[model samples]
Target chain A: MIISYFIYFKLQESDFAVTIFFMITVTEIEKLATLARIKLTDAEKQGLTKEIDSILTYIDQIKKATLDIDHTPIVGIVHNIFREDESRVLPPEDREALLKQAPEREGDFVAVKKIIAQD
Target chain B: MIDLKNLTIKKAHEDIKSGKYSAVDLTKAYLEEIKKKNPEINAYLEVFKDAEEQAQAADTRFKAGAATLLTGIPFAIKDNILIKGRRAGSASKILENYHATYDATVIEKLKREGAVFIGRTNMDEFAMGGSTENSAYGVTKNPYDTERVAGGSSGGSAAALAMDGALAALGSDTGGSIRQPASFCGLVGLKATYGAVSRNGVMAMGSSLDQIGPFAKTVTDAEIIFNTIKGNDSLDSTTISDTTYKTKKTDKKLTIGIPKAFLKGDGINKDVLKNFEESIENFKKLGYEIKDVELPNIAYSLPVYYVIMPAEVSSNLSRFDGVRFGLHKDGKDGIDDYFETRGAGFGKEVRRRVLLGTYILSSGYYDAYYNRANALRRVITSDFETAFKTVDIILTPTTPAPAFKIGEKISDPVAMYLEDIFTVTANLTGMPAISIPSGVSGKLPLGIQMTALHGNEALLFKAGKEFLKE
Candidate 1:
């Protein structure tokens, strides 16, 4: 059973001319949790459905902004700082120290569950 | 006993140089204070065991006559900024036992100055919330009033300084993290120009918005810390050199701009408004001109920040999947492992933001939300650009109100987010802003923020020194 919620945002351009609605549902929340790689219980999903709906509704005010003039995203002040291509080998002690942090480690490698399924 | 309450970095430097107190004696005093007050204030997560040794090293430098200003200065570092071999979990359970492999660039620079690091301070888990209530360890209580909170995600840093646990502290401001806490603790905080400080080795939040800054008792102390940690670094490609932005020249007296229309909006406390007016009057008496400037699209800053910040957070936090360095949980398969690990590791706010960011950056809503927010971001930057033509700096109350109770705004995420309304524009436009201690209201401290043109932190320091009469 999926519960759907709708948020109404009045566009800045002729408020009467446009009222756009975005719907967020428990199903959508589940899908988002999956994509975000976090497991949530049914109760958590339901709570997020309501909470995210309100937050999105509040932030949806950006839609009403008139960005007709040069809306290109500002990339910030500094750009295109290219450094010389260089590679340096880590010290053996440093390599051992880094490898020691992994939870499950093989000889010189971090071990993980197999992704490929076999017959 | 060292006069920790009135001790500034300059005074400490001179005292240590003049043999009034040795570096070890200073370190012992702070450690004693941390032991006495930390249990109640909950400011320090873990006081370093080698702090005395670090101070001894500083003393060695002093004996060699190679000491810098920061030598022997005890500092409290936010957990997000790494120190090699130290446990830097960012106050989250996910990385509870995780140790840093290398020093952060800022930490490296401070180490070169022979500074003594006291401990890792507490913060919001992954810096996802405005209050430190989101910390997995515990909440850092306000030093001024124990019933209330020390403003966060840099709460512990502010509380450390407010309680005289450390002479100065380092904090990362995604939006208002540093400034809000500084205001709450009656201290000065700075968020330098976005690229002015290198972000290398610091945990990534909103990549573009996060800048490591200092928390100090006075504006001059804050300026000294800023000078040491700021500069271009090859490790961080986004870093800017001294000449990255042309320095804007001003006439004899610098002009200050007040966004009157924006401040007139609702939700601002009456006391804050009164304090702001008094600040204006004080500046007027200081012989500087104040003008009302319009930021037409400035109201959109909060909404835009929500969109852009979460998007960047979703991307940046993806690295913490429990495989390489942090906590790990076992599951049926590789995919389930990620789900199980992240589900147990992340707190409520971290989960919510990651999910929201995933939703916003998802296929269907990308153009409607993320792109539109970016478009408005450009407009907001331009709004500030236009206003800077006449004003040397812009003034606003750091937070709409003083620090609230620990659980006051914890339940309501949006209400907590409103704490950054006045502080996010600096991040969006990549400007340098300083939050100086204004007069107190009731028992809580209030602060006024001054934002200068890009790469013009000198102007902010000058105005802050004048305003605080430092």
Candidate 2:
């Protein structure tokens, strides 16, 4: 089922003004789930479609915000901290301990399903 | 008996030093309380087996006359913070049975001070929800009213302290997680200025917004924990030193600002508002100047935070791809393997956020949503900067109301998100904020949050101590 979600954006100009409607649907949700690399059940997809639509509508209020100043997001007080490049090796036991937490491991390496296929 | 209910870290330290009781005795008292109250509260996921041993070491330190303020104190650590060789899942099935390979920087620092690790507390899965109901293990019930929820994603830490299961606890706040639960449990919680505390070894969620903080019975205890855990670390370059931001000179009496326009909005509980007014009056009586300040762009904080946090979460959580550690499920192909594993590993709320983040950062929506939100974030931050010019700190109710019932707002994500309205502004502005118990609403506890300018935690500490009369 396709659910039409409309996000209204009002744009103002000296000579003209207009409202733009953006539609989000189940197809977009499926694409998002794929992009996020999470498999969603059919029910979750349906529920999330409605939930995401509502959240989008709520957040759409930002579109009407007028940006009169230019500023980057303030991450923290300190910025551009440069550290010297150094190579440090973990002790063998510490490396082993870290590798031990892996679901599947072989020797010192984490094991995964074969990626490249051959004829 | 240790009189655990009336215990503070300073008093406990003095008692341990005066030989009133050994550190082992204190650890055992907390362990016994955990055994008794944990079943009902579900505060702790696993009580550390070596708690007594750790406390015994503290006793050794006392004998050597090397005891610090936190020495011999038993602490409940939030599951998201790593303690070497202990299970440190962020209360999610994805990381179930995972053990930490190294101690978090805060844990390492606490160990140096001879603090005892009682256990790891429960939290919302990946610190995602506003209530502990999202925990994979079980919901942590409020110690005051078991029928109600312990506010989350740091719910277990708050519940643990409220129940006297530990002397103090650690919790990470991303959009009110620490303060909300602290308010609900009648505790003092501090989310220090961003980068004041290192994030190394703590699980990432909203990298820009996440901050590891303390849940303590008193404002003084919270300050003690914050001082110990905060510093510049080589591992987390985002950490700050004492000299990071130039100190702001303040007058003899601190001036408190109330954003009247913002507080005039809808949905605030009447009792909470009444309690907030009472707190303002108390501040006045204490000789602190109270002023009305304007934060014109503050109303857009929540919307902007919802945009920026999820975008960061999507980028930060991509590391848990089922290849290296934690829970993994196999599928027909390599790509299918990740899909299957994450699908089975993550819970509903985690999945919802990942998808929402993807959509927000996706092409076409990136400029309109993410970039626009970042621009608005700066404006909102500047609003606080402007307000602080006239006021030393800003005050607001920690949450809109007291703790809600377990299943109350779980079904409605927006309602749950609304609980962080007053708390998120601090995170967005990268300022230090503390939530202290103001009064009680009905049977539940209420809190008043005080936010100070970036790198001005001393002002917050002073004002909090004054307000709590600590």
Candidate 3:
């Protein structure tokens, strides 16, 4: 198993005997920064760890009153679709613009690092 | 004193075309209205400086007898939708400096139809949270009450429409983002059939569930915008135009279905139930049949949406590497500082979902979580297919309750999730659903949600128009 540092912490409180635990996984701390596409320093990670732990603790407390997952049912309101078969192309400029965002654009294609090394 | 603010798009368009009013004149009036109302409503993040220029162009088009139904109409789009040369932040600090390099497909289509994009509206950061409070920029206030939250992640879109800042606003829905916010703000919002509108340019929250739709004060405006943008595009392979047919009519007997399972849900509010029941009576009065139906599989939607949405989110958002786009935070002074960049850039909620998604789709847990959710989604889809055979459409409360105060449920994500119970089913099954204003007596407005099978969006439009008439 590939394991990374992810931890959770307590957060805030409420009434009605409902729990309010807000745990932040260590992996989440790592991942969140990745999403913002920002880099984090070791000291900041340490700070976030404390903050997430506290948040999780609060969330856990409120959730204590609610029934566990097995007890409650899931529900939704949308339905199935069977769409018509059709082919339409986006304008050339749109196609080209999307391709332009790629790190490497080669001859109307988005060039990527070769995933599989050729034998 | 006539309330031009209350005019529908059809009426406004007719008036504009007949010289009773000019598109430029209408745009100026609305611009003034936005200037008056925006500060208190907090519905707009930025009003376009080019708005007057665009209005001039629209007026010029109208005078030349080249006005399409949407000519010169000022509309604010959720900040997520890419407009060429404009900032599309997705309400996150990370993308604060990133300008949209190109217009999204919807923007292109709307621009072609002569719709003026007045500016960008706020949203939950990367469309993560149930309330606009999660926005990194700042919370978008509810139009009815400034202190209360506008429901999200498309909260600002709904608020813009509610506050009369724009005639209609573009919003993207993944799960209940559009409908729930529309319900809270007393506007019309739609999540079109999966793949109905191309998801080419917007910052995506979930690949399978994400869709670009509209929020308008009236149903017809929603229809007008939907018609203008709905089509198949090769850029987004998922979108298809199954039913090229379109019209809004309620002349015959239409069957409306209500899931028996939802009637007994633990989280449904009593006021919501009352509002929904009244809508049912109104539908009956309008000569429609309402029936009770059962779909035991409906319960799995939230878990499924959460599972699938996060997985896709983790994938789609991978492109925002600090080296390439938006805010770049350098840590440890090297290329690998990318991790630190995201750590500093994303908000707490966006991070949580990314981790949850990565964990669920990981090597060992994929089958147990992601695969199981996919199987459950199929069951949910089948259940809807079965119901549609018996009824023309299904009607439920858009959200389980009305707007909750800013801090009311922010502490408990699971409890706050109850607000999406009525809307997730549509996302899970890739169906078209609309939230329409049911009634409003005091500050709070109530909503009735209607869902139809794929490609049956025309039926939804017809049904929605009928509801508005009542």
Candidate 4:
């Protein structure tokens, strides 16, 4: 499997004609997980590193796709749809219903983790 | 007892109108079947308690002479779609208790027509995976062979219809979510054009690729359900009026396009290819011409889709933060709260896509991955445009192979994504496609897919009806 990866990596390098050396290490996976705001366990991080490496190797073929069209217009639902910027008040019952979905609520306000603190 | 298996929407409507049976009776028959089969199949996450009440209302409409064709029909809804006062969990523990405060535009339209919803069907959590195995609830088993998957993110919708648990069901297609499962379960599934159906109430996966559609036992039944639920809704600005795409009935001589380069690939299963050829022969018997066509950029569709879809998924699913609704995990800090809540809430496949999407859209690699894929997406769209000028519809196998065992491809995400190879092109191009049961290999059924130009569903339905005649 390691040999296969090396050959595939070399082929991708030549196929896409890009000059960057690449390997999806565990540290990189941890960075991406952080960027995505999802915490992964140590074991999950290792497993995902191997899986993402294989996935990236497979999808690397897209870099090799030859495109003759510089910019073909996207073909569906391109019309500009505008709506009026307006505020509407919800009924009391509806307001209660919406507020009820919050994990924590104080009166009519949804409670959240605080970011600002007095020094 | 009503012969629910052989019942179509038209026959059911006629029977109700003629007083042969009431809507209450029909709903009871389906609810009874759900009770019997749902435990084993796990097709439905929750069967609605108000089904019979709604059917009674439909009976009132029929008596008042205000009945539409769907007035007394029972349909299954995928869990992602919001029906007010009902739970719409999307088969994830995060939203297992979330209830919609308002009905989706489609649900409102169906309600006006007096349709009965039996239950919310199970799905892949947040509509992430191909097989229903990724569902936080449980896997939906194929009715034909219980050991295998029902094929999803719309597996429950298709499985319920396949087992005659519901007369029809609604499903959303982001990639092959609808058609592939329909193919696997021997049902008809349609992925309508991008903006053809309003997405006001359906859960968003990939915004540009997702469209809600129907799954049923027959082509005509699928068409009827589609027509009832489709139309422009002012709430969803992306919707278009019926006249947006000028549709006309076709004559007997209809031309079908076959992308030889795509089908010529050795990766496709032989049984699937054989079944496709037999379908071609069947079309010839119907006096239609089958011609070879080229879609040069077609081979890149799956790769392009992986890039664009994950990017969109990451953006759309960002709304699931612990603040407003759904699961919340308290932590040491605000950022930790965000991390652990989402970490535990989302399924394994959902997390992978989100992270992959983040990687692609991040600064350094953005142009190399996401931007490149978007430009290639244009190439794919135009290929369909050029091909449609020559043929009314394009044909391919719905899946590369039939449904594999439950845990067959789960470990390797790439292998599971490959199952969508033949079906994602339509989504990438924003075109309408349908999958119909063509034939069977061994004990498993195979499906043949037909795609048409934007707003050309009339042609797809026309051809689909003729193809299924045998």
lDDT string, candidate 1, B133-166, tens digits: 9999899999899999999999999999999999
Q: Pick the candidate with the highest DockQ.
A: 4
Candidate 1: regions farther than 4 A off: A1-23, A69-71, A84-86
Model 4 residue B439 distance off true place after TM-score fit, in angstroms: 1.5
Ranked by DockQ, the better of candidates 1 and 4 is: 4
Per-residue alpha-carbon lDDT of candidate 3 for residues B1-470, written as tens digits (9 for 90 to 100): 22556877787888888878777777777778889988877788889988878988888888888889888778889999999978789988778577788889999998997888888998889998888888887888888878788899999888888887888899999989999999999999999988889899988888778889999888888999999999988677676775443322446689999886556633566787888888999999988999998776565566567677778888877777655457766555444455656766788677766665665677875765666677677777878888888888998888777887888877656556657767988988888999999986368888999998777787888889888982
Whole-model alpha-carbon lDDT for candidate 1: 0.89
Off by over 4 Å in 3: A1-119, B244-251
DockQ for all candidate structures vs. native: 0.43, 0.42, 0.11, 0.45
Q: How far is candidate 4 from the true structure (C-alpha RMSD, Å)?
A: 2.8
Task: Tell me the tens digit of each residue's lDDT in model 1 across A9-49.
Answer: 22223544354565689999988988989999999998888
Ranking by DockQ: 4, 1, 2, 3
Between candidates 3 and 4, the one scoring higher on DockQ is 4
Among all windows of 10 consecutive residues in model 1 chain B, the one with the lowest summed lDDT is B261-270
The interface RMSD values of the models, given in order, are 6.4, 5.9, 11.4, 4.4
Give the Cα error of residue B239 in candidate 3, in Å: 1.6
Clashing pairs in 2: none
lDDT string, candidate 4, A6-116, tens digits: 243345333646644357888989998888889899999988888777777766777777665354336475576777888988999889988888888999999987887
Clashes (N, CA, C under 3 Å) per candidate:
0, 0, 51, 0
- After superposition, which runs of candidate 2 have C-alpha atoms over 4 Å from their true positions? A1-23, A69-71
Q: On residues A1-119, what C-alpha lDDT tens digit does candidate 2 reach at each position?
A: 00111111121112232434446788988899898889888888889988877677767777667786454566866776677789779999899988999988888899988899967
